[model samples]
Target: MLFRVALATGLALFITQIKLDFFESYLYDMRVRLTPVPTTSGNIQIIEVTPETVEYFKGIPKAEHHKKLMEWLIPLAPRAIVYDINFDEILGSEKNKKEFARVMESFHQLFVLTNFLEMRGEEGKLKLSEPYEKIKLFSGPKSSDTANFAKDGVTRRMMINYQDQVMLHPFLASQINTEIVDKFKIKGLFDFLETDQVYIRFRPTGTYAKIPFHEAYKGLISTQAFKDKIVLIGHNLELSEKDYLMTPYSRSSIAMTTTEMHANMFDTLILNNAISKAPQFVNTLITILISIVTVYIVFALSPAMGLFIIILLFISYLLISYFLFWPFGIWISMAHPLLAIFLCYYFFIPYRLIIENRRSWEYYQKNKLLRQVEELKTNFISMMSHDLKTPIARIKGMTDVIINDGFTVSPIQREALDTIRSSSDDLLKFINSILNYAKIESQGVELHLQSKDPNNLLTDVIRKHEFLAKVKKISIETEFEPLFPIKIDPELMKQVFSNLIENAIKYSPEETIIKVISKEIDGMVVVRISDSGLGIPAQELPNLFMKFYRSANAKSSPIKGSGLGLYLAKYFTELHGGRIFVESVYGQGTDFVVELPQN
Candidate 1:
């Protein structure tokens, strides 16, 4: 069990480190769906560079179009104007650059997106894709780099910094809100990006207010709409596939635009609500704990119970994870914990059961060998008992001849001979008891069923035991009902009754009465033999019919007998479709009851 738990924990850790994307992606998407929709900050607005606007500037150069758009936006006195479009190449018009630079210089803060492009001639060199030199003169020292994507090619995190010639260029979102960045002491771009990468808390799509570039340029939207607003100018229309990026909110049927993604990043930075990955050690601990608990439950409980517990734990863990992401903004790894549970349930549990089953089979085989040895011992004792009975019978016959065949002997010799004869008779009775018990144990009772009156059978049994009863001065009384004639093995029934009566006589004090009662009830024959002798001890009554099992009280008595009589009696009675039980008190007498099917 320990090994399996360790194996599962180690396996979960390894899988978590490697991060199988197929599973993790699904989990991440689930967390995204669970996140509450973000409220729109009304301070931020998007001005989409639509296809209509692109077509409107068909006759004009792209730089000229930007110049015209900026010319219109500059009069609004916006707090900041952010351009999501990149200007990598130089527009070959000095006149357009001067005009754009003049319009950009009029604004209080103007930020243009830049990207770090790999230089073609250099193996490991990066250069900034900047706007025109005249345009850059007015844009200020920091240009936001627009290069941030997860390993899965999704834009979930923003590149807070980019390295160019040993210099750091902060991300656009960070540059827009330098106070938040400095306040949080955010450092190390990718570390901060990956570890503190915020899940985009998105408002419903199409909810962020947008104005068409042509509408803005044509003076259709009033300047009041842009007053005191942070204007983000970018293409909202699907100009090409490269213009779009996948996000957590991206579904199978829809993808979020890069402009909307920027808005989300901007809003996240403003709110300071970036979701972060839980620490590696914490995740590992959670995975290991889950693995160990799953293994323990599977081994400790029954299969059905174990399955129920596993499912409950799984659902509870999921709920916890959902709560953490939805409310607390923490994205702990769910893949590994879920995998650990899966392997423990689907793999480890079945393996343990197989091992247990093998052990059980081995145990059964060992017990079978022991039972065979016991059977051999029983058979040997039975054969020896049969052989001794004959010799004892011959001894009795010789003793009888010597004592009774016209021989005169002293009283002492006659008494000695009688004692020897009586001892031999007792020995023969013990041997017969052993043989009868062994016969039932080694083989089985074979009954010869005959229709017999219950009263007549009881009478015969009582007559057989009358001498023994008289020796003890015990009265044997009978109460018989008009029992219907039933089929039974007469010899076995006689033995059963004789054993009960003899036991009663042996245990009872002088003049104690032993009562035998027979009756019919509910289509069954019932016979009850109750004795006022020393009743069986309450603790010993349960095992009273087991072979050779003598009670504590019986062991201290002077009664001379093997303990096989009652065992054989119960065996024979049950073979004829009957049940036997004894009810007794510690000092009171016992009542042995036998019931048989009437058929």
Candidate 2:
């Protein structure tokens, strides 16, 4: 088990680091997309430069237009304002410049966003675009707002430390402030951050209150909603992909604008919820443990129990991983561990089936050997019984000769000779029963079907057993209805009937009458022979006709029986297309019923 676990774990973790990282990131994105941390994006607000504002201002508005917009927001008492728009040219009039300066100084910290496009010219020379001299005139730090999207083209991280300092890069403005982690230190972020870490956790779009730039300037803005709030201003023209980018929450191919992307990052930082990825070693260890545990239970337990446990373990792992990702912001290895579990199930179930099959094969082999031994024992009994029949017949013939040829010396000698003859007859009958059973067991009994009178045949069988019944002081009663002359093997049916009558007489009490009835019904011949005798127990009824199986009473009593009588009776009756069964109540009475198909 240990070896298999090790091998499977090795194979599963053998995936290249690149492949593993990709899948791990994919799974993380899925968790974020499905069960994002429930947060109220109540604090964030965006003021977009919509197409209506552009049309109102006639083409994209100029810097003086932004200055006018900020003038309207100053009375709202915003904590800070972010301008995602660029000022690449000098203001046309000094009047416009002074108003822009005043708007910038009105807020405690106004972040003016900048864009840097690094491209190669035709001569392979670097082309850098510098902001207009007017942009430098504004106060406060003007950081580049270019965000770094991941390799998969997903914009998941909003802030990364630069020159050992965590700087607010892009865009953000807030209306509410609670437990904000926006001021988290750079050194602390570096201690846990990875190059591939996803720090941006965005709530659903439309969580923030957004208004058009023109609407805020036209007395449509409310001071109560913006008071002491952070205000962000950006362009959100319809059909504009110039600033649009993909966020973690972006579905299909629909990407959110870069302005919205930055807004989500600021919202996440403020909430102090920066989800972190566990180290690579952490995933490796988890893979090893998951593989080992799966192998231990599946390989060591029964198939049913193993399968049940695996399902439960799989479900538990999924729930744990999800909860850890959410609210806890801990990313563990899901695909790696789950793949290991799948591999275990794929191989272990068939291995268990093979084990069960081997056990079944062993059982089959043992039963076959037992059957062969039983056959050998029956063959020995048949051989010995056949040998005894000749000797018993000779003994009976010699005793008869001595008594009939006047060879008896006296009354005591005559009685002794008679006893010898009777004992020889009894021995011959026992031996014959064994030989008959052996013959039938080998399927050697051939039926000789003849249309014999059913009543006559039954009467002959009962008459043959009359002497035995007389000896036991049991009377034989016959009720024979006029029956059809059905095709039958007379000799075989006679023995079948004879066996029933003899058993009745042997087990019945003195002065009890055994009734033998024969009749025709439903194109069939039915015979019922019943006696007030030692009845068979109900539990023993099913095995009554099994070869060498005797009733409990018969086995315990001194009554002479080979236990093959009823078995032979059933076989002979079936050979003639008939069936025989017995019904009995313990210690009360027993009845034997026979049914033969009539044509």
Candidate 3:
């Protein structure tokens, strides 16, 4: 336990201190390699303007060819059209340019793809600047500012916004979403925080709608359907290299193509569900930590207790993950962490149980039957001691009164009687504590459940403890609310509260305050008793209510206690179907709360 604690603390500190970006990158690559991602992009018909298509159409007249393409596009209404080809040169005649412009105007959904070029000259550089929708920069501002390419100087990603009446990007489909929004009158932003990839609904599967560019001019395929569909005018132009990017659909040459990128973006805008970047490192660390903590607990705890703790931890993990992921569409994988816990338990638990059994056997062999006999003797003595305690206390009190007030005695005799009385009181307390433990073991304490007001019960308990608090020079404050009555045994519950308060008083320093508050929460009555005293160690918390279990810090304290008080209190509370719990930070004092269901 100590080693694991130290290791976790030291490693956390070390990880914080180190800059391991390169190493992390390597790990990330390795992890990605370990997990295979298969590409499932369906085939899309490519209308390539290759040398063959150009030759077949006679000669490649750029303007005339574009006109012919548009004619073909006007009929085959594709899901979208991307004009990947650049019109930067304006090489054709002014009349031809106007004709091409008219063709562009005729069709509305065509995504005319272009680039956001970044050129750096010694003093000045001259370049035409244009904004288009879906044609904007692909990158963020920081990357755009300092990014100058070595090859044909161009910015891969652009920073621009798209609104109707203005094209924002150099991409083909950037205009589609804005146009749709304008047409549909849809308002507000769609958040794609968790999901990454968007799924496009339909595209022509085979070569029915697609034909060679030259063939289009030759009336090889019908151009009837493209009248209203998006048309992309881009080339398999060798001079122009497409922007390569990763989309959930495809990641190869297709992603690089200008038309496809527009299609991908458009699909995402429409679908609104894209695969998001899950926090891999964060989830991984959390899972592993939880597993490790579970492992430690399993190893350190007794079987029954360990099983209970495991159940609790599992429930906590489920609730946390459910709240964190399901409602918000976040995906944190529970498989690995839960698997680690199960795997560790699968191997470690049997090994632990075996070792524990062997140790128990060895101890049994050493003591033979003596240990059993001694235990039985101690139990008997404890029971007898407890049975005689109340009467003995009464007799001692009467004797003290008689010796002090009624009879004249020597100083030595009086001192002896005082010592006897003190000893008798100590013995009586020990006996009562043991008797409580025995009663719990035998299920001798029966609860009489009734509609008990929590506030009134707290008040009564506080009243009984006020004199004790005064003796310790402590202030006891009670804050009670109008609470619903809960089913509980008043006598047993009073003992529970009294034991807890006594312990609080015993541990608290003089001039300190012990505050008790009772309130109702979600069909349950909660009583909280907070004290200004040294807190229990975090490690000791799990064992706090266990029989004969005393914390190291508590044992070292000057305050004397039987430790059975809390154990008995817990037992009695459980008899009434209630729970007691504590929250504390070392040196920051503690808060003990008891809850009973209002049923």
Q: Estimate each model's TM-score.
A: 0.79, 0.70, 0.37
Q: Which ten residues in a row have the lowest lDDT in candidate 2?
A: 136-145
Candidate 1 structure quality by residue, lDDT tens digits, 1-599: 66876787776677567655556656876688667776665667888877777677663236676788788887787877877665643253767766776777677577665444333355233323333443331111221223422245554555442222211112434555566555345421225421322344555467677888878877898779888767877775675655566666565223766666667756766665667667778878998899888888888889889999999999999999999887777788788788888876787777887989999999999999999998989889978988889989999998999998968989999999998898997898789788787777767668899999878988998997898789788899999999778999998888888788778888888888999999998988999998887787777878999888888888998877688889988988899889888989867888989898899
Two-way TM-score contest, 2 vs 3, winner: 2
**Comparing 2 and 3 on lDDT, the stronger one:** 2
Model 1 misplaced regions, further than 4 Å: 1-19, 38-42, 50-77, 86-101, 117-151, 163-179, 183-204, 207-228, 251-254, 294-316, 341-365, 396-426
- Sort order, lDDT high to low: 1, 2, 3
**In terms of TM-score, which candidate is stronger, 1 or 2?**
1
lDDT of 3 by residue, 290-376 (tens): 656866877888888988988888778756655543234344545555555565566567767797899999988879888667668
Error of 2 at 226 (Å): 2.8
Model 2, which residues run further than 4 Å from truth?
Answer: 1-39, 50-59, 83-102, 112-209, 217-219, 235-242, 245-253, 262-337, 353-382, 397-457, 479-495, 517-526, 566-582, 595-599
Weakest lDDT window of 10 consecutive positions for candidate 3? 137-146
Badly placed stretches (over 4 Å) of model 3 are 1-379, 403-423
**Candidate that scores best on lDDT:** 1
Arranged by TM-score, best first:
1, 2, 3
Q: Please provide the root mean square deviation of candidate 2 (C-alpha atoms, Å).
A: 7.0
Instruction: Give the lowest summed-lDDT range of ten residues in model 1.
Output: 137-146
